[model samples]
Structure formats: C-alpha cells, structure tokens
Target chain A: MGNRVIKMSTLYLTEQGSILHKTQRRLVIIKNKKIIQEIPIFKIDRILIFGNIQISTQALSFILDSGIICSFFSSQGKFKGSLRPVESGNVFLRIAQYERYLDKEFRVEISKTIVYAKINNEIKFLENYSKTNFKEIIEELKKNINNLKDKNSISSIMGIEGHSTSLYFKGLSLILKNKFLFEKREYHPPKDPANALLSFGYSLITNEIFSLLSGIGFDPYIGFFHELTYNRPSLALDIVEEFRTPVVDKMIVTLINKNIIKEEDFQREENSIYLNNIAKKAFLTHYEKRIQNYREIIKVQCHKLMDSVLNKKIYEPYLED
Target chain B: MGNRVIKMSTLYLTEQGSILHKTQRRLVIIKNKKIIQEIPIFKIDRILIFGNIQISTQALSFILDSGIICSFFSSQGKFKGSLRPVESGNVFLRIAQYERYLDKEFRVEISKTIVYAKINNEIKFLENYSKTNFKEIIEELKKNINNLKDKNSISSIMGIEGHSTSLYFKGLSLILKNKFLFEKREYHPPKDPANALLSFGYSLITNEIFSLLSGIGFDPYIGFFHELTYNRPSLALDIVEEFRTPVVDKMIVTLINKNIIKEEDFQREENSIYLNNIAKKAFLTHYEKRIQNYREIIKVQCHKLMDSVLNKKIYEPYLED
Candidate 1:
C-alpha cells in the first residue's frame, strides 16, 4: 500500500481571455463561444496569467480563500504586480520573524546556513557533470562554505553568496552542451533563452515558497537573512537562497542540456527574450517533475524553521548529503 | 483568448495506508520508504479512502481550513461516513435552507423545479439517440414535466422522478450497443460493470455537488425535495437529481457503448462487481472529460440557488434546450 496524494497543479492562464464568474466552486475560462478550461480553485497554488487575460473579482476571491497567489505579467515577459491574500497572518509568527532581524547573532547564524547550503549544492551539482574543468569552482565553493560558517555579518554572507553564484554559473555555462547561452545570470528581461529560463524558474520557485511560508502563518515580506525592501517578499528570497542551485538552476540546465527546451522556445522582441507558449508548457512540465524530487527537501527545511520559531527547535538549513 | 482553470482532482487512498502530517502546506503521503504523493491540501476537494486508511490530526486541520471533505468507505464498496468541516457554516444560509423545508409551498416549488429539469434532461438525452423509438418515452417525459409543474407535494414529485428515471434507463439500455448488460440501476455493490460504473460516477458527481453546495454556504444535509435523514446528504441528493441524466448517466452509457469500458475492467467477488484499477482510471478520465461539458451547467444552477437564498432571485433549475 502506498500513500497517494493529489498533486496540485499550477494553472497557467496564458491565453488572451478572461475568467468568468465562478459557478459551483469551479472557475470557468471562456474563449469566445467555447469554455476553454474549467478548473477547481482549490487545486491551484498560483494563477500565472500572461498577455491579455482578465480575472473576475469572484475568481480572485476564491483564489484568496484557497491561499494561492495570482500573478499577472506582460505579453513581452515583463513582471507585473501580484494579487495576494490580505495580510491577516499569525501575529506571533510575524513578531518572531521580525524579532530575529534585531538578533544579530541569530541573523548571522541563519544567513551562514543559507550561504553554506547554496555553495554546497553548487559543488554537488558540478560534481554530477564529471567535468574536470569544474574542479576549480568546486574548490572555490568549498572554501566559501567554510568562510560562511564563521561570518558574523549578514553583509559578508550575502557578498559570499553573490561570489559563489557567479562562480557556479560560470561552471554551469561550460557544461551546457547546446548553443543556448547563459551569460552571467541577467534577470530583468533576460537577453538569452537560458537566462530567461533561469529567471522564470526562480520566480516560480520563489512564489511557491512564498505561499508555503504564508500558509504556515509567517509574514512573507519579513526576513532575517534578506532585508525587507519596498514591495519585495524578502522572506521568500531568504528561504529560496538554499534551493536555487538544486531546484531552479538544475532544472533549467537539464532543460537546456537535454535539448528539451530550444532556441525556438523563445520569442525575441527588441532586447528581451520571452518563453513562447510551447516552451512555457514544456518548462512547467519538467519543473513539476523536478520539483517533486525536492518537494520533501523544501518542506523539511520550512518545517524546521517553524519548529525553531514556535517550539524552540534549532533551525537547520537544507544541506546536500 | 480563452478562460483557464485549475482542475481539482480526487485522491483515492485505497491502499490501507495513513496520511502523514502536513509539511509546507502540502500533505505527505508516506508508504514504507517511499513518498507516494505530496499534494497541496487546498487543491483537494475530497479524500476518498477505502478500508483501513488513517489520517493524521494535522492533515484533518488543513482539510477543514480548505473547506474540503474526506470520506471513508468499506472495502465492500459501502460508504461509511464523511469528515466534513465542523458545522460552522454560515448561520444565515443554513437558516434559509431550513426555513424552506418548513414552508410546504416553498418545498413543493423547489421540488417541482428539480423534477422538471430531471425529466426534461432525460427527454433531451433520449432524443439524442433516435427520433423514432423513444417517441413514447419522450411523450411520457413531456407529460411528467408538465405534471411536475403543478405538483404540490414532495411525495408525488419523488414518484414522478422515480418513474422518469426508470423510463430513462430503459431507453438507455435500448441504445447501448455493447454486450455489457444493464438490467437496472443497482447500487450497494453493483452487480455488473455498467451498473458499477454508473453507481461510481453518480457518487463522484454527487460528492462534487455536495462540496460545491457546502462551499457556497449551504448545509448539505438540508433539502427541499429529498427529506433530510440520519447520515444522508439529502440536499446533495436533491440537487444531483437534475444532473444525473446529463452528467453521470451519459458518461456511463458512452463508456459502455463506445466499448471504452470492458467486462474485464471489473472484478467480481461473489455477487458484487467492482472496478479494477485500469477500468477505474479509464472511467475517471472519461468522467472528467464528460463532466467538463456540464461544468457550467452545474455551476450556473448552484449560483441560481445561492442567489435565491441571498438575493431572492428566482431559483432556476437547469433545463437543457
């Protein structure tokens, strides 16, 4: 007997349509005379609508009740605003989340853990390629991991994280067998397909962690490792740091190397590169498969954080075995 | 551009397993060393577990928050009970639902609507098969539809519903092209594959409507047409009547006639016929496809009901044109 769970799917409403009024708890998608897709709001974590899509107020209410986020983006792949549930989260967790910021020792400890895990996962990923050229970066990552352990300042930890990511991507670029270019992790309107994928994948994972943390009663905007900035979900970024290499980076690399995603998967407009409809679907399918592999990894780490805040258990970051 | 929705899937934990605690807002399904399924709790409507499956306290709490239902049934295919969110539903809607039952005129009005819709949909169904052979049943259905309009008692409406169902199934049996037999609509351990599928399909639709009605703030146990009894979701039953012919019955008949479901798809143990794993999967796939056609139909009717209670809008039962 196996424990079976219902897999929740991300509803990508990329078509130029509008969401009709919800009837019987089902969200209706009408395209002209035909009802394109009818999804139950309960099974959705986020609604990522691209291009000219309109969501009714009723649909948004159900999305909020289901504790999912609705993100709207421009057709040219520019990031827009997201609709989130009203911030009526647990005050106790919120207080604890903010309190950790004032505790310099606590902040350093968590920041060090995130940097260590990120660097460690990068080393593990490069090792999987069996390329001798990556030995330099791997050694560099190892040294950074040790450096991160003694770091007492959040600034120094973030500086090391930035350095390690640069080295990791340089090493990753060498292993990408295809013509898909990855040039230094450019994010805002990515110039290449590879960067576009990395940016898209990161947003997907970040939003996922944001919803999970919020559902667990934490304020998504507060953070200890990452500074709470204007309109930024800093807590999500803090938690997403350790997961970058293993989840999003690895998935994007695999998609490129396996040639499952290609140059044609992108739409070129002026200086920007965006994922075409086919590529978005392919990337999502592959990401879902990849995410399942690390689902426990993400859950376990978050639960440990909750345990630390509520039950006084020590927060342990996810480190590759 | 078309509308898109997230499809809610039913999770059947029939493997005598237990649901682990919720982590990261996603339920962990552990069976031995393997993690079977990790689903977001909000994305699930009902967890149908058959025989010896256990759920943890934490998982139940998440289920309650998401306004979903978890049902348990015997391995012998008998429904045991459902763990619905504690009856903390809107007092206003529940009061309206209960008040309608006390008003005999109100009760008859709603009952007549349900019967009229059920009979009208059946006539529409038979007309799809042939114009010649079903003329008599069509006329009978028309007579029942007219008779239903003037009915003042719940008992007489129930009688008409019963008679119309008999005639509908009789017409259906005539149209079924396969060797698979459909002697009568049987439940409590269906005797044949067709009957088993019909019963199973009906249950799935009924449970769906139950959750939908409950989600819309209606108490599932209260009803107008069907009498509220111990352990019965009478309101769900009352609403399901209008949908049975179009959604469930058509799906079962199509599956059998198209030979998509075979006799081998069932397992016979003494006198009971049960759907085998493969057949169950095929049935669900087709059921989902079939239900999508009427997704709007169900939603529209439920919305009408909600409006009737909240805004005094005339409750319109679904009448197929």
Candidate 2:
C-alpha cells in the first residue's frame, strides 16, 4: 500500500515542461499554456496548484466525476472556490469519522503527540549541551523515570516537556540565524516557521487519518469537530488536530539538531519566506522517508483499528505518549 | 418600505402567462414553476429565500452580475446548491457570523428577559376573577401597587411572571376545549398542536415575526439564538422565541377572555388538529388588530452592560392589551 502522508510538498515540477493546472477532476497540468502532464481525474486526490493558472470547464466535469477535491487561492492570494463532488458520506463512514474525533477510538493520536514532546526534549538537551557541558540531563531524566520511588504528578511531567518545547523552539531560532521565527498557535496556511512546522505536521496527521479511513473503505472528506464548509475538507482538518504538535515538529527538530539543514535553507520574500529549492527538496525527501520508515507494527495496529471501524468496533486514539 | 409580505391568495404569475416566479437577482423565487418576479440583489449581505422554487440560467446570470447571491434549496425542503448567480459568502461575513454566535451578541443572551410583575398582577387578577368566581377572587386579592412597593427581588418578580404564564396557558387551553393539549412550553413545528386553533396561533406568531423583522429594518433571516442552517430561515426562529409566551400566549388568553374564537373553531384530523377557513380568518384578523393596539410602554433596560448592543436605549416592544 502507498504511504498515507498528510504532508504535501512541491518538487518544483523538475519537469520544466509540466505546468500543474488545477483542472476540476485531475491534475491537468500544462506547460507554456499547453497540456504537458495530465494526472487523470481518478488518479490524483488533491491538486496543489501554485502561481497563476487558467481552469477549464471540462476539467471541472472530471472533478465532478471523481469524488476528489481541491481548494485554490488565486495568484493575487484571494481564495478561489473549491472543486468538490457531493457525497452522501455513507452511514458507516460517518461513524468512523465520529470515532476518529471522539476520545477512545482514535489510536494514532497519542503516539504522535508523545513523539513530538520527546523530540522537543531532545532538542532542548542538545541546545543546552551547546551552551554548557550538561551531560547529566537525559541520564538524570532516565534515572528518574526508572526509579519510581514516588509517582511524580502528571502536571510536573507535562511541565518538563512544555519547558523543553519552549527551549527547543527558542534555540532553533538562534541556530537558524534570522532565517526563521516561532509564532503562537492557530497557525494554518502557515504564517511562519512555527506555523509551517505545524501545518506540515498537521498534514502528516491527516495522512494517517486518510489511511485509517481508506482501510475502512470510507471517504475521508466528511467530518465533524470541524464543520463542513464550502471549500474545506472537514475530514482532513479533523484528522490533523492531535498530530500538529508531534511529527512535523519532531522532523523539524531533527533537521535542526543534526545540522542537516542550516539557516541558509530559506530566503525571505515580501510577506513570506520561501524555502530554497535544496531545502524544500531535503524537507520533502525527509518527510517521505519519515512516514515511510514507520514500523510495520504501527501499520498492523492501524489496520486492526480500520477493521474495528469496518466491523463497527470502537478503537480509541492515543491522546498522550 | 413594502410590507415584508408580498401577499397573493393564489400564487402570482408573470405577464407571460406563467405561474409566479420570484427571479429577483438577490432573491430568485419560483412558485409552481414560472419566472414571474425579479429584484436587484442586495450588496452581498445575507441571502433569504423561501417556498419551493427552481431557477433559470438567465436569473443566475443576474446574480453573477450583481455579485449578490443565488443560493437555493429544493422547493419546500433544504438547501441543495447555489443556482444561477450567487456570490459565495466572504471571510468577513463568516467572521461576523462566528462573532455573533460565539460572542453572544444575540437577543437570547438572557439579559433581555423582562418581568413586568405589576402589569402581570393586574392580568392575573382579571383572569382569577373569571376563573374562580369574579366577585370572591377580587375581594381576596389586594388592589394597587401598595403590596408590591419596596419588595424588589428580580428572581421573585421573574418567578411571578413564570407562574402566571403557566396559569395563562392552562386557562386558554381549557377555553379552547380539549381540541388542543399544549405541554406547557413545547415549541410548535407544523405538527404537535392538539387542534387547528393552536396551529393558527402558531401561524399567527410566524406572521408577527415576519412583520416585526420588517418593521425593524432587520433581515428576517439572519438572526441569533436559532442556528441559520442552509434552508431554515433562522431569523424567523429567533423572533418567534421571545413572542411565544408573550404575543401568541397573550392573544390566546384574550380570545378566551372575550369568547371570540370558540372550541367549535377546531377540527380533528387523525392525531392532529387544524383550523377551518372561518377560524383561520378570525385568528388572522384578530392578530392584526391586536398587534396594532399598544397598551403599556414596558422597556427592557439592559443596564450599562447591554449598552454596547444598541447604545443606551432599551428594547421596548409594543405589548397590546
């Protein structure tokens, strides 16, 4: 089975002859305003078109034919209409969606969140190590976990992770050398570095959701928690909520910690920052690998949950590590 | 301003010898399948359409031209899609909508609840006289505001009105006979009333709402409290809420007091009750007259807290005797 990743990145259409025109159905790409590449309406699920593009009605007919969708923003940065096909969203599909949202049934939730916290802690340890020879940090933390002479309060454990996330984010900005800045939460359609990581992480989470839904033969578009709006895929939004803090953040932290991608990885545009080609490629490649490298155990478990969804059994998603 | 109502006993038709079609740019109304009427669209404000209707491409073109709207539903049912020329709602509109909901800038914020205990006392005295031997009840109950003076407790006052409302509903139902069995404060929706008189009373409330929204220059569709689902005119729902215990309930009491519309005015159909033409006309005519008659000038003063809604001025609806 193909890797279900919510995270999407553009490869800059290395095929210079290819122009990704967001046709209604499939990725009816054009080059020099002529058809160069055409991913059939049924083949592709999303069309992330960038820059100026012209749309045709025939493409729309295809989009309407396939139960796929694409949301667009014009070059002038105004939201264009969404290309979506209507669906009854079936009874069982809705049940699974509700399961994914309600506590108890969404299993992918906690693992992803915990991974994020652990990565943030590691980042903090690394940053502090750079500033001082702090060799006792992780060792002491490990020892403390092992020696459960007294059970520490959950808040204290969470407090430690929270401090680590803050420390990691601050240290990351310093290492990026003015290339990035962290921001407050609620960053979608990412406004900055923190938001970018959040959106990217969120995308990865959505991939899991899609995979889970697909396993149950359900369309991952209809959703609750997030309302079904005109252009938004409410299901995608629903799946991404718990993962925004974990996977994407961890990936970014890893890249920064290992010094694989440096401060020079991006360039500042007028009101936004653009990832340089090399950085974008490296990020996409790493993203693909991270989702790909997941152990078969997780997949097996997800399949079990999917089975439960299909057979109408309940499976709860993890909320914390 | 034209009456919020465009009344025609029978559906209106265009000069083209077709049935009435309200193909207005902003409001494309189609009744019994014919394009008869058209009006300029509002400046992309809120769209409000009712009745079962269909649309033509030309009417949609007008909507596109005016950038107003052409959202329609299956006739007498729910919203299906946008037809002809409907401009999709913008972000500001969405934000404003969310603000009205989440921020509680709505009429049902509980602050608007009033307790005119003095006036209610008088009404109660009169009702008691007729119900429990007028001469004896009048002697037992004290007259004037002497007893109520200086004993100011908001809850106590509100409680008095609440109790009076119960008595009023019970007494009115008895006069209307076993034709209607109201379950205290149950809401009506097409069905549920025991007889036609109750249904007529409910319908009378709807008509009053339509008029009230018109008189205030407010859109009768985009209101708070009740949710504005795609097809349901939520504004009508909101206006109807406050008037249930006051207007309709009051009118029913008056009718019983005067013996105007009688128990014979009702007829049973299976499990439900409906009014015949005579009863309908009596109710409608009386409703119109009563709405026009203003007795007391009771106002809802929202203290300094509610001043932000409509300045320092209080809300005062015409309470007819």
Candidate 3:
C-alpha cells in the first residue's frame, strides 16, 4: 500500500547504550534519562548492541517474538555473543548436515574449495592495496591447491590451510597504511587496531553465517575446513574463511585508507588496542552497510552450502573478483 | 577456486522428457534415445519436468545428492508436485510457526496484511494495464480492507479475501490484450491461456515459498489466511496470496503486452486451454526471469514472516509503490 514503509535492516545501540522496553505496543530505547528511539517491533531485523546495553523482560520477549537477531560486542569491538531465535524445526536438514561430515573424501574436497577461495581472495586483496608483488604467496597458494587434489585427509587439508594462511597474512602486512601496523594475524585481544577491527569484523560475519546455517537446520559446530570443537561454531568458521578476505579485510583497508577509523578511536592497553565506543559505532555502521551490499551474495552462498550438504555437491566458497 | 563454476537455477525437461542417469560421476540427460546434456552434480538447483519424464534410481539418487529440486507439471502447465530436500533441522522454528496459529489475534493480524497487500498490488497491476477506470474495484477493495480492521474470525477474513479476489479477477479481465480472453479464473483446468498462465505462475511462486519456509523450519501446512487441509501446504498458500498479483499478475500482463505469449501458443481442449511445449518453455523462461527479478523482495518477505512468527511483530507483506 502507499502508506507502507520499508523496514530498517540493523538497529545499532550505543552511547552508554540504553534500556530497551515495551511502551504502547512498541519497543523504545531510553538513554541518558531520555527516550532516544522507539520502533514498531516489526520494523527491526537485527539488534547490534555495542557495550553495556540494558533490556527489559518485555523487550526481550518481544525480541524473541519478532525473531530478531541480537549481537553483542564489547566496547573494544570484541564479539561477546548473540541471542537469536531457536533452530529451524526441520530435523532432516541437520541429519544431512551431520551425514556430510562422516564422508572423509567429501570433507577434504569441500575444505579445499573453502581454503583455496580464502587464500586466493587474500592474494587479490593484498594486490589491490600494495605495490609489492604477492607472487610468492600466490605461488604457494596455487601449489597447495594443486596438492589438495591428491589429499583426501582432513588433517592434511587443514595443514595446507594453516600454512597458506600464514603466507596470506604476511602479504597482508605489506598492504596496511603506514600509521597502522600489522605483524601477524591475532585473534584474542588484538595487538593493534587493524587486528582488532579484523577480529571484530570476522566475528560479525561468523555470527551472521552461524545464524543462517542454524536457521537452515545445520549443526554449525561440525565443519570440514575447521575441526569440530566443544563450543565453537566450526562450520560457520569454515565458511567464514572464504569471506574473511573480501568482507572483513576489505573493510579494514577501506576504513584505514579513507580515515573513517583512526588511532584516536582506539585505546592502548597492555600491548593491545581496543576500539573506543565511538570507533565501535563507526565500525558497526560500516559493517552493516557492507553486509547489505553483499546480502544477495551471502544468501546465495548459504544456499550453495545447503546444496552441497544435501547433494554432496561441491561447496565453493565466496571469491571476490 | 578457478575450477569452480556457477550453478544453473532450473533445468527444464520436455518431449517424453529424459532418462536421467549418472555416468562417470556426472549426471547426464538423455532424450529421444540420445544423450543431450551432461552436467556435474553440483551445477543444478532444480529440474523442471513438463511431460512424461523418466528417471533412473541412480539418477534420482544423484539428484538427491545434488540437492536438486524436481518440480513436475502437466503439459497444460498445471502443477502436479515437487520433490525437494528434507526440511531444515531446527525444530524450534516450526514450533513458533505452529504456536502463532493458536493465537487468533496474531492470525487475524497477519492475514489482514497479506490480503491488503494482495488487493493493493492487484489494483495497481490492473490500473497499469487497463485504460478503464477501476474506481469500483478500488472502492470495493478499500471497503473490505477497512472492514478487515474490525474482523478477527478466520472465516470472516477468508470471506473478505474471496470477495476481494473475485473483484480483482474482474479487473484483470478488463486489462488483457484483445486476442487473449479471460472470463473467469479456473484453476483445476484453466479456461483460457491467461488463466492457465496465472495458475502455473502461482504454482511456481508457491513452491518457492514452500521450499524457503521448509528450509527455515516452518511447517508449510500451518498458516494464517488459508485454512489447513490434508495434503495442502496452507501456510505457503497464505504467504503466496501477497505475491500472486505483484509477481505473477504483473508478469502475465507484461508477457501479453510484449507479445511474448500469443493465443496460437495455446491449444483448446473442450472448455480449457493448454500451453504448447514452446509456449511452456517461454512461460518458464519468463517465470524464471521474473522470479530472479523479485528474488530479493521474496527473500526479505519470508524473513519478515519469520520475524513476525518468532518475535510477535506485525508481519507486513510486500507492497509495490
């Protein structure tokens, strides 16, 4: 109808955050003793909470009812966790998802596709930002990919991934802007702002894929590229590898090059750089926009993964051209 | 990876269809006693069988392995059935889907949104194609929509939908190209080419939603607008209401106006008309293109429905401006 309105994609909560509560059949955000924003529950898709955001029981229930995905990140842009709706009701998709992991040949084949896509995209990214020839990294990546043809063991596939990623990161170091320093890829408590942004960005994408896979009734804890762990969403991590370069790495480079995020937005603490609240907000905004731009591609990739699991078809990771 | 290739969306099989089988790790399609096409298992998403299509067990297993959806239709373009992979593994999404139906207020609220969007888009479509004033139809639609505000009974809502849809078909009849006759919408056997296309197009959209809902772990049988019936995917039918006019109706009008489909393309059988093989292919091609065009919108609407079921948020149907 003419009176209809477009729904907002992600709701970013910040600035001492706010206490979200139900008011007059609508969800309202209150901050600094003032009402900030009130939206009809239906208008929101995801809630991106940065820092200590408070929520009332009614609001949480409404969120559950709305099936909105809520993502929590620390003040330093570290991913805490997410509160999403329950898994899909279809039990068979999980059975198929689980069944695929039992096939060693299938696991190795798919893992090769994921890691190859990741390394290749990394080579492409570094080539775009740096004048340095990534010939060596590219050569090594190609060799390992060729070796994947003869490899049918998960451990061998993982070894190739680990070795190739180090070379990819070494090339990544050559592309950073002068003020931003990148030595190696680090996950917990990143040593520099770039690493911090990269880690946070990776978490954002991982959460997204996790929700998608879980929503589709896949066991995210079991994966091919990444080994199964007690608590980690290994499958999401496996898929995350392909996207890390084009989605996260690209965002980090653009943020630094364009001066969207700066050293002032990060705080130094015990050999680690933490993104301040303001920087976190900026990052969240950009992260959401980036996701929106690639929403179609991401959705298609998810379906492709589903197809692979159900049909034992090849699972090719996302490769940015 | 460089070796990876994009998968095709739909594979249409015609003319005593084909004997599909696996040969040396590839799925091959044989028609008229000759091999016509051979594609890797991963390259296909769905197989559209228009006539007497034959499949070997090995081929069926290969299709299942490829996770390829198989949709069967009569020569007249009537939907027979579809074979898709098992539903999503998550049991909770379906639980929420079923729970929502128990809440009368929720059912009534969502039904209103769906019917309103359907009527509104129908009015828009007819107005675009008809030179005649649609004031009466528009007024009737508005009256029923306003009446929907006070009505909560499922029967009452369904009554409104039926009445509104009749008026909509009446408006549709006024907009068809001169040679194309559309007296009334007949589903079991479409009375005219227009009606045949309409039924076939609706079937395509319904199946798409069914697969998506199943993938999201919602029981396609449970719904808000349409009443549940044995062997009927009522929920998919309910959601299909909002999409019928905008996606299917608009495409039908466009196909006629552009001369993509002509009266000669159909054969009269007693009182009904059936699309010839060539016409069916044209329609399928256009159908696929149209689906691709609205793919993003359809995906968003499904997510919105999921949001509504899970979060108690108002489910807003897609409204074209």
Which candidate has the highest TM-score of all? 3
Q: How many backbone clashes does candidate 3 have?
A: 13
Where does candidate 2 chain B have its weakest 10-residue lDDT segment?
A: B294-303
- Candidate 1: lDDT of B46? 65
**Candidate 3, overall lDDT?**
0.73
Q: Write the per-residue lDDT of candidate 1 for residues B1-321, one digit (tens) a residue.
A: 012114645666655544455677787777774777677766665676555554543465456556566655554344544544422335355445545556788778888888888788888888887647788988888888878867778998899988988888888878876477787778777887778877887887887787678667676666778865544667788889888888888887778878888877778889888877667767766776777778767878887887776665567888777
Q: Scoring each candidate complex against the real one, what DockQ results? A: 0.01, 0.03, 0.01
TM-score of each: 0.48, 0.37, 0.48
Question: What's candidate 2's DockQ score?
Answer: 0.03
- Number of the top candidate by lDDT? 3
Local accuracy of candidate 3 as per-residue lDDT tens digits, B1-321: 212224345566765646666786777878777987777766656676665566554455456445566655555555554544432445455546656776788988888888888877877776665355677887888898888878878888889989998988888777778678787788777777898888889887887787677657666767778876544677888878878987898889888879999988888888777787887888877787777768668778888988999998888788877
Interface RMSD of every predicted model, in angstroms? 19.2, 10.4, 21.1
Off by over 4 Å in 2: A1-27, A73-81, A91-161, A167-321, B1-321
Question: Which runs of model 3 end up more than 4 angstroms from their true locations?
Answer: A1-8, A23-26, A84-86, B1-321
lDDT of 2 by residue, A201-273 (tens): 4554454454345334443444433443543545444445434433455677677667667666656566554
lDDT of each: 0.71, 0.41, 0.73
Per residue, candidate 3 scores C-alpha lDDT tens digits across A8-105 of 45677775646777776688888887987777777666776666566654565456556676666555555554544432544455546656766777
lDDT of 1 at B193: 75
